[model samples]
Target: MRSIYLRITQPVIKLMLALTWSLASLQAAQAGETPIPVEKFFKSAQFKDAQLSPNAELIAFLAADNDNRSMLVIMNSKGDATPTVITRYSNLDVIFFHWVNNERLVYGISEKDLGAGEKNSGSGLFAIDKDGKNSRQLIDRFVKAGAPKFRLLPARTRFISTTGNESSDDIYVGQNSTERMNAGINLFRLNTRTGQTEIVAVPPHSIDFLFDPSGQVRIATASKNGITSVHYKENKNTEWVQLYQFDDTVEDGYSPVFIGTSGQFYVTARNGKDTAALYQYDTKSKSLIPNPLLALNGFDFDGDILFDNQQNKLAGIRYETDAHASVWFDEKDKKIQSQIDALLPNMVNLVDKGRSQDANVRLVKSFSDTHPGNYSLFNVDTSKLTQLGVVNPDIDPAKMAYRDSVRYKARDGLEIPAYITLPKGRPAKNLPLIVMVHGGPFLRGGHWNWTPAVQFLASRGYAVIEPDFRGSTGYGKKLHQAGWKQWGLAMQDDLADAREWAIKQGYADPKRVCIAGASYGGYAVLMGLIKEPDLYRCGISWVGVSDINLLYDVSWSDTAGNAWTKYGMPKLIGDQQKDAEQLQRTSPLQQASRLKNPLILAYGGADVRVPLIHGTKFYDAVKAHNSKVEWIVYPEEAHGWGLLKNNVDFWTRVEKFLDENTAVK
Candidate 1:
């Protein structure tokens, strides 16, 4: 490979001119608005994940290596050659890569200096050649005991999707099926250059798959006891067929998304409407077509559907409502997304075009709400954009922090959907707030970019918010079935009605608010300090869930024997022997002696999701009569904090526990 790109092309051009002179001297010492540190808002992102190569004339990304690990380079989408690297390791860390055609690429690795409880679950998979030549490994980073599995493909085989046939190196893997409890995912087709294999059609209790722009597979999806289903097949010698099933905690049917090249399928449902749109299904009358083809208003068709397969149609959809848009339906990819949104007129650009039908290169990406994203390239017959880096080249979008997207009313009139943010040259009034919360209290919390723990609590001056409250999930179906079993009652009163609507819109500081989260937002920060103890003046809760009947008595939680805790946690969280006294009146280790303010409680002694016995049994029952609690733990972290020195030692102990409890006095 030209003497290995002439021996690392002068240390990759002196690491891209010392990362462009260290991002121009850290944006000129963050133009005097200093504060931005706590490990540059939790590290890891020196240019990340960019993609583009299925002949969009090369681009690939992930760069860091000067020992910050990641490393996978490659360039030239007209930025005229030179950038090569192609792979690196010295210990491991190319976490996920793609492009299996347009001169090969596939990737996976991981172990970025251990500590997810001493890592190692399977990152393995390799395969190279973009000029680093025929590299290879193809799966085996750990899975040994009795090592002799002949056709070597173990270490839990993954990488699904990328067979849109760029003249085949074939690539649709998946492996999972450990034989019983919810046994699904087993498809394969391999051969990313002769590690050869070809099973390709399991479909029994499958857990999601949907191929078709000629690479085939045609839909799959599964679920179990609480129902779900949706199977289908029309090629590779047919025979799969189940089609429609539903009731997986009802939002009524559909799902799939993408599989057309004339065999059309596309999905996303909630047909009786309350959100979820995008339609077209009809595999000869299995139904679904009742209008729609992309709906959104209150959100829920969530994203992705692009598909262009050398112009076999449907070239855009993208979605994600409180931000992250894209419509296109192909008018030259909607005039190359309005010429890269009239030259990045305030971020959120996107524009992809990977499996290119060539409207001259594309890629883009961009971002906003205090920028933490970049990746460029655009071109489109010489209009140009170029760049291709910066995902946090020392941040500083004028000292980060804007976010916005509001909406309130939750003490019954429903509405909710939050995300505030503040703090960028302050004065959105009172301030000091935190309210953060999101840890999938049923997923989808805040979106509208640049969030490193909400820009590290708005670069330390605080004011954060977040909300999505009532059972979260891309807003719809009456805000996700209105907090199903209402854990800690009406999801802890929609986070104390988002701290009294951020202190009645004076942007917070009703006595300097506070309430943070992790896992189910650390079980709603110990049920929001035991149901709004004078509306939170303190509480943090990392890797939370202090005993909701130990989520069905923790039989080593991966959510105890899955199928989402036997049929989606008794229909969405609750029911441990029929809500035993409403799960001990909302367990925070059973109310930890009605928690008196000032608390911190972090965890992850190798957290198996909210594990170190949910922060050592709620810091041994709120330090027996709370003496201003503060716990911590981290023994090789998990449920969160995957080492950036434990996210700068747990946000520098949340900046001295919000400066000894809500600073502004």
Candidate 2:
């Protein structure tokens, strides 16, 4: 709290030291083990995303205001001046803001929700100086009747960037239509000072444009009907020529990574191989430069080049393996990376050179499985990483539990990778286990990160098991494709197998096991209770799908789900027409009667992905079956709660539910 207060500019503003959570003093139930408060795990972060300014002189970050609302706070990178609060929206949180130049910053607003889901609250763009003066609201994304922000965002206008000169009055913008999905975007150069627009170019289709360091639209890509296309131009004045097009049905397709100088196009795609590899497209030959530039073999390289602004060259590639990792291309940057990693050996050191060609000074953020995160300034010439501060000041490394990467073979002899976090200060024994399933079943669900949810459960004497089941990505291509169309059946089995594996290892009490997840993981929880009736004692699902049919049919929902309905649903999920019976049979809402254990259902009132309709209908259906149901509704929230109050409220209730049902009372 003192560190957070020191960073706050105003001293006599009556700082409230009354934190809802604390870590200072604790009773050691076991030697060297302090009981972590549940609120500490579930509460809003003390500070949010941080970034160094263009000159590396100013460090801007989002910090919890005295009111706990998201506020923009700026401090000197060298710690020469006190941190100043720039923009304070008492009603709305500044969800995202960026330093376009040394003088100007553009920020967007949204509800203070968890997971940082991009749900704009019509509270739009704001521009301010480094000193918090001349603050101007650039655009109101969806206008509310309030203090006039800037001009209307022209329906779906998004700020691209201020091209060459950050001090220039003009900024690049993309205008697209919300009326249609996959609608082509019109690129524009708008006067940031006056809100006047100049048309740069109109993309061929709803293809997204890629701007280079000089703010030139170099590459464009779009995918529709399971076929994707890429087009590139030497200059904005040149004719747009088709670079290459690939069948999106072939997995990763020809996805553009980043564009280099002279149209050196880099993309991730599999020509014939399973995993997508990084390749450079040679314009003269009009083909992918024979071999991959950087291929991770088993895993599709899902990262981008670390662009060196000073050198105007590709620095290195930063991609994810288990956690976020980086590989450098530039020797200078690589040398610096090596130095930083050696210094912060425990954490993944992500370094950013602040608009300096010399690379004498840089900002480094060190993070690990155990370490929440700490920021530092790498004085390359001095060869010292000056300690900045931890991302979460509330967390103490001494009290946090260790995360172990574990794997077990499924019934089918397929290797299932997982991370098991045992409770702090306890030996591996028959502990009450929470089988924490992840949200995105198709995504790289369970990575080794400092997750509050996982650590929170582990702090409560629960063995938290996060399994990257058959369909989860990031491991390898084969693991992900195996989950195609598995849904409630094979996917559920993989989770069950993980539980069985844990129980067999004497780490989990089979009688005290509970399944928990969000989104598709939440769907899996229902299926787990349904298919394996004798296994889990309780289950928790929030913002989860209750019906696949609803996912396909909800036109007003998020575009990702709707696109999956068109492209992936037929092949990956199931054919809506032919596989109608299978979809229904697998639907948790359809099979609500199978739920015989304690169940907690949570949903965001405004969740467009899996709307309240799914939760309410499932709740009603389960009520008829006369099963124990705890329904939690967060009205203002979208997919997940963003506000600190809502997060605390929801998690506190969940803690109670688990304690009553799964705790060894």
Candidate 3:
């Protein structure tokens, strides 16, 4: 559409851009040459979710080579005892861990079925000794089991029960189906000495269960109409005291937590205009006390109550100023604030004192994201920090560019959150932009640390933008739920709006822009190529979901099949049959011909999530349409490429593709 003068000048512009790219490309090439493997940089002593033993002499933690296959390790606190791996199942994974005694440990182990013609299997209750010696299968059969910490009660042994459809051994029968997500729970008692398991509570449909100080069961059962009624009972008595009742909507918020050693409870309740925090029954006064811990006033907080064996006062994880701060109460109601303070240090001062502001620490936890996250532990008392290593050490902080958290108003007048990383040592002008969309369409992006992909893009003289589109978690429930079925509609538009916002703010060069993402983000990349063809000159999609309809129809036999119904279907994605028209319109597979940008599609050959078929079909469809497409598949990898060679290979291909298509300089 350009005039003859502009057309004649285009060749000179292309030449100049190439010359600038080659000169800048040399400096960028040196940045990617890491001394160690990128995977090694991610590993090296980053232990997740620490659990000190009841005696506080030994500790158990989960460590992984590269956040792939995690191992359960136990080490003594004061002794010169080397940490031992109690878990050794290559095929099966340990879900949760519990200390039954000073010498024994109990955990839930299950075989994860990757849905590539695989069958979904159930997990079982497994017990191992403290020394990793006596490894025994307590359940004896495959069943859906959960981890519950055991407390040494008076006359008998007991544990906090997890309500799932567990049988005699507290394990479910088999794998869950593709359509059936609902399951019930049963309380069971296991004798440590004899390995004998007994079913204690036989409620009809117990949805959630908690154990009091005396080991008596407080169960919340859901009726057929989705109404939850809380019942408290002693021993195996049929008579139950109905303490509270609530609609299905608020049942999740009413999740029980044991607070005091004398069986006093703490729960959050909605009172009038605000959800006032309420304490459990004060038997002497026969009234509920209004909790004064104003810090955890409105937000829902949950964690293990760290008690000092005597069980006199309350101590647990609490939040303050949007950061985790621990609160513990002494006998005189003097709350001791030291544990969280010891864990999360004032890194702002450390960053100001010679360290880069781009630095971050994340606590890695098992069940909860807030529990044990990626972070360097610093002793506030001693002012000494244990460097847990970097999340992306492959990218040098000195040479690499970084982004600070930024927010812009969206088209809907909502404050859209995003991270902007400008290349280091660049003049504040119209720079080439590469918008990197995160994988989880439902997971929100934040100021937390990330991997090498973002830094790598920025190192090549391009500004990177990551928009935490709607439906992402962390902001709040309302923001998270707003993304329900807005896949290609508002969700994708948010990304485009982000790029437009960047350009309008004079942060990006409109002539040189590209979109890149992985998995769900990959789908976004292809869709960006289709929906906004002129906005982007190139795109890179790795293991992206090409067809949402195909994903809905995916079926597996064993554990994978159960996950399809239980976790996948009802949680994030809607049914394709019901949302068929929307799926077709949103899916990238149907709009392959509309892909006018230079595209690079990367896929793992053994991918079970969005199977290799998704990539294969898209590649064939695009090739048939005569679209410019580059395809790369790692034969050994599944879902994600793990090998360091594969990582370098993918990035090298990406850089070259952008250089040839887009104005990278």
TM-score for all predictions? 0.32, 0.88, 0.67
Error of 1 at 393 (Å): 25
Q: How far is candidate 3 from the true structure (C-alpha RMSD, Å)?
A: 12.2
RMSD of 1: 23.4
Best by TM-score: 2
lDDT of 2 by residue, 260-305 (tens): 6556678876767766777877766778775777766345678877
Alpha-carbon local distance difference test for all models: 0.78, 0.74, 0.56
RMSD for each model, in Å, please?
23.4, 7.9, 12.2
lDDT of 3 at 339: 33
lDDT of 1 by residue, 300-371 (tens): 777787777776767667776777767775577788788888787657887886776764878888888778
lDDT at position 170, candidate 1:
76
TM-score (C-alpha, index-matched) for candidate 2: 0.88
- Could you tell me which 10 consecutive residues in candidate 1 have the lowest summed lDDT? 1-10
lDDT of 3 at 381: 37
Lowest lDDT sum, 10 consecutive residues, model 2, at 1-10
